[model samples]
Target chain A: MKRYLKICMAAMIISGLLLSGCGKKEKQDPDSTSQSGVMKVGMVSDLGGVMDQSFNESAWEGLLRAQNELGIKIGYLESNNNSDYGPNLESLTDAGNSLIWSIGFMMGDAALEAAKANPEQKYGIVDMAYGNNTPPNLISVLFKSEQASFLVGYIAGRMTKTNKVGFIGGIKGFIIDSFDYGFHAGVNYANADVKILRQYVESFSDAAKGKSIANQMYQQGADIVFHASGPVGDGVIEAAKEKSKWAIGVDKDQNSLAPDNVLTSAIKRVDNAIFNIVSDLQKGKFAGGATVVYGLKEGGVDIAPSSDKHVPKEILSEVAELKTKIIRKEIVIPYNAKTYEKFYIAKQ
Target chain B: MSIKAKLTNWSNSAKRYLDNTFVFTLIAIFIGLITGAIILAFAGFNPFESYWAMAVGIFSKPKYIIYTIIKATPIIITGYSVAFAFRTGLFNIGAEGQFIVGGIVAALAGYFLHLPPVIHAMVAFALAVGAAAAWGAAAGYLKARFGVHEVISTIMLNWIALYLSNYLVMSPAVKRAESEATHKILATARIDLFGVWKVSEQGMAWRMENRFFHDLLKPDINIGIIVAILLGVMIFLILKKTTLGYELRAVGFNKDAAENGGINVNRSFMSSMAIAGGLAGAAGALQVLGVSLECVNLSNMEGYGFDGIAVALIGGNTPAGCFLSGLLFGALKYGGGKLQSMMGAPREIISIVIGTILFFTAMPKLIRYFTSRINQKREEK
Candidate 1:
């Protein structure tokens, strides 16, 4: 009985502390307090969260820049799972954000649904192209990621000493398919004799599987590996570091993660695309119901600036030449298996 | 003297009430909130305002409440799955695998079979549950016959299930064109609430007349919550009243003693796992029919099963306890996003609070020790 009394007192004290801590503030809706007339931009991150240091992080960097330059009130919500996509979009909508950005192709359906539901709410999504069925209030932002992958693949083909290179992907969707086929085309163009080992981790976030696959590829005499698998690329870099091999990073300049082992990164300028969209909206030039494709010609994709540290000057010059060729429509990079077959036949 | 006596009587009764499991959970929750407050203060945010923002985020809109319930629905069922197994002395770590298996089967059934509305959903649910039950029973068989530790086998099975589900989702028959996910389930298989009415013009006109209902029904509001709650009650009753439950509990308590008492311990083990798997599979099926409507090609485990372990632990492995705890977790998750949007607080703050709560809940002995130490000091005084 005495013990129970002691427990009761402890419970009372804790509850008292909690109540007292909250009692000082009146119940105020945070949404109600936002000042009107200032355009607020809200972003909903995919399951990768903002700190993923890959695709999502690049998009966030764009938002941060807009916050600094455009003088717009900016905020973002991180989604923990697929279930959070709808509610996160809804919350951003309820907050009266003038424009909402859904970062990642995974949120394409959710963004479209939310835009249809709230006709007045303007939305922009990255990496998803809804050609004909796009809602009137939503803008689709796409990147020719294959252009950058081909450049990195050319570097890997030129630099490999063991005559073997590898390509690791996250999933087999059309988006990732582009990365795969372009890499194959670039490798074949650079050195037709070099064997290209290909595999998919099937997840954008599984670093362990990525590392193991990279290790196996390295053991099988592949000297350079290129990965487009989001955080899974982190594992590929780690494995490269352990084996003293080389890894080509994706989406961002990932040289900082492994300075010595990273050959280069296939840079997809998600940050630039996002900033461009926000600035366009700010300047009253918002284009909705349109698919905006960013390619090498538009400066949306390129090999990393850090390529000079590992890639030879001659190879870098050759990559530059290829980039110009692609931009000038002199060379058409294949983005899928069928296109790759046609391109391969034409090149032969 | 009369007033003093009355106060003492009231204090004694209050002490008795505080000795309950519910009160203990409340105390842990308060401690968690306090920890979160400290973290918020350190991070340069006003803790009070941040928590208030979270509360408003959840309760300010009817749609938020519906979202919370939707998030809670699967975890609650999964919690019951884990709780049921724990009560029967089995640690069902493969609830994740069972869940994926269930989702895969349900997606196949929902898309391939063209039945009438109610009947289609029922068939999908049945197939999902049965498939998952078989998946769980395989682990049980390995344990019962080969003397394998369930923990090891279930962990391996989890990987198998993940790969298998991914393969199935990507297969031509199920795969949606140019998409990573499978085709969406047929309309007949969907269990969404007011499915036809919500989309129809007449229903829109009616909703316009009723604004509150219009806002409330905006989410994928479905019968998942109702089904979860009914299963919780049913599970509680089965454990308390059924002979099968008695046999399972007896085996869990002492296998040798139960064997001597004419119980088939091996059979009990298999039965417990099958039931647990069925519950988890039902969670997956409901999630497919009521929420996602398609099976996604997973890159990694979705983690509902692992979260169930925490839910069961916090709920003290009881059906009623699981329901309440699952709701608490769901509210925290849905509400935590507001902290990021409104307060600019890192989402990790919410994770820290939940971790602290789970840590405290796991150490009931330490709490009791502190209480006893305080009582000892009082006696000395």
Candidate 2:
């Protein structure tokens, strides 16, 4: 038995070594593409995958736009988790993709590392801004989804029958907190007496949790609930349908997901950012070093047009007026609760 | 010799090969690969090219090797956690909870404590492992004292760990100001070897000249890999050589018999679980101080704890087996990105392959049937 075990161990080691030796001889040949003279663009999706019908999907649409109009060849890898980001980026870069786009803030560190490793490989990441000194080969794209959420909050405050609005957030972070605080600020801006309740589902994918939380808020006399929780927001819409209350959508115009129930969506144009960056890269005018802020003024953040035709024209006009003031620097929107508290205190 | 005699001798050799556990494992592996190939063919992909790309992707780049080792380090400990419990006749589904608690404590210790470099890492590690062991022991106590099913309790504890860690991260004292994660671990607490490298122009020039060497020298390759291997060996020695190990195995093989023979079965159960938890806790602490952004910023469980179950299962419930299996899983995970880009395949395909491999490994009846067939041929001859 001892001799047999030794032979087995030796065989295992030999096979393992042989497998690795075979890999070394291959030298990794890059896949050849038929699209001559077209720039190769690679997009790496977050764990939500490309078919998420939200942020990741919208980003893919932008890449599709570049593929069709700008004649760039596009390939996408859907990351399974946070750990996949680095490997996905490296694989895309190794495959001769000159420009790579990584969606979401989760890829911030991975993209930063990849940028440092291959200085010539240009990268664009969504919802991330490197403080001050970003790598010269990377461009961080950020959207003021809070500004759009603020507009939706104003609409909710204007339309609610109970003078109470609710917000369901995905997780606690700067990005998600922006939505929460902006919604609160907007509700108070519209009506200081309006009560704004808040809760977080603590996940981007748990729609059932989102539904239960939304139902609780509706039970507490909140007639309108806005959610910034990716697919989880779908559950909020479902709960709104059950309660016959208004639900605000996010990321894209999700009105079509539940037409009559959705008041409007807080649109963050990930597609536009991706398309614009790829276009710039193609045109030899890529702005790499600087962080790009895509806010309401940039048309990268806006409230989707309401599918409900009966939306009061006066309310629409008022929102448009507020958008102009925001663009003109007359109203500085708060992105966090502390700043919003200052605005609330000053009003008092 | 007659032809029948020669045929009998050949069949006898075949039976000897079939009787070897190592050979049976290799056969299972071969079948698993074939199964993966069949699935890929049905899915309209060339299995050879895809697998080749995966192999090259992981080994062709020096940085990729480091990444694979880094990825394997945590799972290796977690695998041992599950394997150790399995050997003691306990199911440690609570490895996830133990891992999370360990990470939370380590992150807190790393952020709050001030000590010299080596001492800081050691203290943080000890705090994490001790907390995790206590957390795991609670489940063991519930089982021994109240006869509660550990499976149900461990599963419940996983959710508790998740929410508890989430709450801790949100607290003002633990949370970094204006950030989702806790404040970065002090330099003294960092486990990366590159942190201790002396700065010199010669070193800088050498790094810049060779990209591969520069990557190998980066802080990405943490000391956790060495710790993982050492722990694996330690567990192996304890299981194979110690008196306590003999008692633990006896209790595992037959708790009633071991108790009748004057063995402390309850104590064995608690100690085994505590050890398992310690391994899992070490995995969590190493991950936080070594791998993650140097702080715990997990919105959800990282899934390494769950993956350890698969690693232990594939490793055949032994420390050395767990280590090797952990490395295999790590390579598959790190290579999946290449498979996606090169073959236009979903990364989910890697899961299918791993599942198939485990399926084969778990099926003893299949191996028995093959061995019986060879025996029948020998008898006929």
Kept native contacts, fraction for each prediction: 0.43, 0.21
- The DockQ of each candidate is 0.39, 0.28
Worst 10 residues of 1 chain B by lDDT: B360-369
Instruction: Show model 1 residue runs off by greater than 4 Å.
Output: A1-36, A157-164, A188-197, A212-222, A330-332, A337-348, B1-11, B89-91, B137-160, B170-180, B194-214, B249-262, B362-381
| Cα lDDT tens digits for candidate 1, A1-348 | 445557557877875777666755554434345554577898999988998888789988998899999888888899876767888899888877888999988898789877766777899999998889898899999889889988888888888889999999987788898899889988888899999999988677678989999999999999999998888898999999999999999999999999999999999999999999899898998899999999999888999999899888999999989998999999999999999999999999
Q: Which pairs clash inside model 1?
A: none
Q: Roughly what TM-score does model 2 have, to 2 decimal places? A: 0.87
lDDT of 2 at B337: 68
Docking class of 1: acceptable
For model 1, residues B1-381, the per-residue Cα lDDT tens digits are 698798768766765665677877877776777777788899899887778878878886878888888988899989999999899899999899999999999999999999999999999999999999888888888999998988898889989999999899878778886566789899999999886677566877687678788777668999999999999998988898999999988888888999999999889889988999889999999999998899887778988888788889889899999999999888887788888887887788777866776776665556767765875796899
TM-score of each: 0.88, 0.87
- For all candidates in order, the CA lDDT equals 0.86, 0.81
